[model samples]
Target chain A: MDERSLPDANLPPFEGGRSLLLGGAAAGAAGLLLTLIGGFIAPKAALYSYLIAFDYWLGLSLGALALVMAHNVAGARWNVVIRRLGETIAAAVPLFIVLFVPLLLGARYVWIWIDPPQELAKETLRLLQYKKPYLNFNFFLARAVIYFVVWSALALLLRAWSVRQDESGEALLTRRQRKLSAPGLVLLILTATFASFDWLMSLQPAWFSTIFGLYVFTGGFVGSLALLCLIVTGLRSGDSALGKIISADHQHNLGKLLLAFVCFWAYMAFSQYMLIWAGNLPDEVTWIVARSRGVWRPVGILILLGHFLVPFFLLLSRDLKRSRQGLAAVAAWMLVIHYIDLYWIVMPASSLDGLGLHWTHLTAFIGVGGASVAAAVFLLRGVRPLPVRDPYLEDSLRYVQP
Target chain B: MKRYVLGEFGEPEDCVEALRKLHEAGVQGLDAYSPYPLHGSDEALELPRSKVPLVALTGGVFGALGGYVMQAWMNGVDFAINVGNRPPHGFWTNIPITFESGVLLSVLSIFFSAIFYFFALPRPYHPVFESEQFRTASLDAFWVSIETEEEEPVADLEEKLRSTGARRVHTVVESA
Candidate 1:
């Protein structure tokens, strides 16, 4: 709207990614091979660890997808500069469809309900039977397929339209994106909720909480926001194109949202615990009881401090959020805590006694994480770093927090 | 008696530019008024950071502590009701009320501090109201006003404001 030249939309695509892609692929292969060996030696433990790692990466990618859809629907201008990065992360959902196969092959090892133990009481068996209508393997597989299809469709369509706009520069593309995203957000939340239930909650078929989906979704969203901060700061330097576009104002805003979601995740976690603790039902209370009593208790406490309190206080500073290194440090810390959070959720059922620090956990995490990073970098190199032709790109570049 | 020299600008940008020039020239007691917030005005005015957040945090911390203690005293020690054989003081149950009171107190503190301390509002009249054209400060025009407690030469300041693009300038004297 002002008499200033806008950044050229015809800018060159991002370069210098082949080494990162190859390195990431190498790490991923090594981790996956080691995890494959763990499958033969300690099949159940390897499967559970792989599940934890799988959930961490999957949730983060979905979180990115959720944010991009929300940005489109709300027409937020502050995020327009870094919208491509989020789109790239979200666009990596198809990769998870391939990664989900290991879980499919080893479902019984991870989920007790898949092959209920013979030592179980008759009443417990009856309960499993009652849940079979919803939790059966066939329905579970169908639902997983539906969830991935829905997620990939939403993510890919949004990215395709956005990329097309780079050359077409049509206002219609923006309108079309908003149109799909408005409904896409609802579809995403529903699918994500069901996905959380199927993959994580089914680990303990007897336990149920209405708020579990929201809890998982919030944590994943927080992780993705942290990842977004790291990606922007990692890619940008004083002389880079992103550095010219993204200012400290943008980082400050991202930090504030990260802080807010950290609180929300805490709230969701606590709210679920409080209600279950109050209800004191035999079925529901057992889940919380198992988590609070054993080695998992200390892990929960760590999440309280590391995931919530420490970052909550650290990110409160106006200066740290604006600084590149400071914000990136906090982001990396949160990503680690997010993995631990998932580990705490999924590992309790598998390892009854201790924190269950296993080599496979590390290997499986590296495998999934390395592959995800490689996919993201590969996707990033294919497009312009930012949505250069977005109608609101200038607003984001000039954005100053009020 | 103090004099308030008011200048009107057709554009908020010109008004902000004039404010910066006046500030650089060491002219004190300068402020701007507009129907909407003008970007860069805070920098031009060199305003100090607001302390409302600190006040809010203090209130919230105290409120949360008070809430927790009130529950602990009333339920755990004072009456010590036995409900369903649960613990007399349930820490988990106390959290929701703790969070609510914290938020409630934070909002109350921010509202009161902003109204009475930061803004000093509820006054009905000011010397700026004497100029009918100044009413546009709230509707359309941008205004820069300088308030001096002691008499200062008015003509040079008026010339500076006009030179910087103030379309109309006038001085109002407050009767004391």
Candidate 2:
């Protein structure tokens, strides 16, 4: 509430800290341009990659929300410094609301299961029918509403508790938060897992991952922590209190969480893919076959190296964990790879045509992801950027693993 | 009321002031409390060691055995079904649930063992609750005590308590 790297309430709003605004604008322009370019020439591969881009962006937003919930549940005090950074991403939930318009508009092209009941393969149809109670257009729309409701509810509640603590230094609120966290964790897992089933898992219709929900969860957590480290560092440079408020120990701790998520994301992704490949069932392997080949294979290799190996090695040094610059470099790398990983997951589905560039996808990317932030920024305006009042803040501030 | 007041230490060459005093005075069976967990509280107090971890480990093993038995009994005998060529106990499939059950059991047993280990059954040694010294532990204070249940009367313990640098010595009486 008092000290910030950007603008504080007493000070005017941080005018130029809106790369997101420009980013959103750029995405809109790109999407519109691609929409026009692809209008006359509908290339299959390009269409597929464009669709995958949607998953990539949405994954970023959803993953951010999941991380916020996990931190709240685990009572991780050191993470309090980056709680708002996570919140900014969670607050972008509304952008997704706008983003989904294109997906909903283009559902048939994206989801084969959305095609008529008689036309789909028998197993696919059976699965589709079984899931119809949940996967039909009406239910899908309803579920989308529900998903956002749960997500936005968590974002609002956690952010509210944090900012409230800024005003009142009562330690009891921290205790109250611990009590609330267990249930919040449950709600987060339930919503995130099933929402995966609704959104991406339904793409193939037949494929399932008991841990697929966790895959999304892990990606979100890693991506947010990277975004978090970068944002917090940016905030800390000039903000005097922030410099003191966040310490080497906190950085080390957050870096460790980042490392853990990076590993978990690798583990879950590998295990899920391995299990499906090992089973070699047509239903399961169908999902992996595309990514394991050609242009997608290089991206796959890049993901293995960039997402897991690079971070794993770079973060190995103890000094890197504690240093701001070292950790920020790793984060920037993580965000870029995360985009690729998201791209890898969705592009394979639309392989019939070449991975053509669409102005709409780029437009939708900004329109969807951009508008999400603009809405969040407007709502988050005047809101306290730090949870100054958390009882655990002091505990977290002085915390060193004893 | 017998009270113990702990005071400043002697030189680095000297033994722990409180323990040296208590041993010299033959103060048998006193309880100690501190604001924070002191490094050598047990050794200074000369209390018998706790075997709670051993009890906890035994309880954990028992819990894991129970989880396995319960699953085997349920899947193998109770309501078994053959799925493909897989065995009824396909414990791999049951790994997640079994592990969860075992963990749940271990935690529960630890809770119960702690109650048994810390407090004896009949609860005969109840001390009167009112004491400023006890409250000081919540803030900034450290003290130790020997019970008044020996050949030595409560008066002897009280006298030794003051020389040990105790801020105050209070005799906690039995309930009337």
Q: Stretches of candidate 1 above 4 Å error? A: A1-10, A236-238
Question: For candidate 2, what is the DockQ?
Answer: 0.03
lDDT of 1 by residue, A1-402 (tens): 123454543457788678989988899889988998999999888998899988899889999999998989998988988899899999989999999999999988888898899898898889999999998899999999999999999999999999888877898999999999999999999999899999999888888898999999999999999998887777554467676667778888889989999999999999999998877889898788878886889888999999999999899888889889999999999999999899888888785448777799999999998898899888888678777788988788768788
TM-score of each: 0.96, 0.63
TM-score of chain B of 2: 0.74
- In the range B1-176, model 2's lDDT, one tens digit per residue, is 43333222222111235765686566666555555555445665566656664565566667777778888889889989887655777654554455567667777767776666566545654463455446665466555656654434766666666666555667665444
What are the per-residue Cα lDDT tens digits for candidate 2 across A79-142? 7655665766776665666556656766777677677548556766777788877668887788
Cα lDDT, model 1, residue A359:
92
lDDT at position A258, candidate 1: 94
**Fnat of all models, as shown:** 0.30, 0.00
**Chain B TM-score by candidate, in order shown:** 0.94, 0.74
> What are the lDDT figures for the candidates, one per model?
0.88, 0.64
**Which parts of model 2 are misplaced by more than 4 Å?**
A1-51, A116-131, A168-179, A237-244, A354-369, A372-380, A400-402, B1-176
> Counting only residues 3 or more apart in sequence or on different chains, how many pairs clash (N, Cα, C under 3 Å) in candidate 1?
0
Model 1, B1-176: lDDT tens digits are 87888999988778888999999999999999999988889899898876887998899999899889999999999999888888989999999999899889988999998888888877778888888888999999999998887665687888888888899998888877
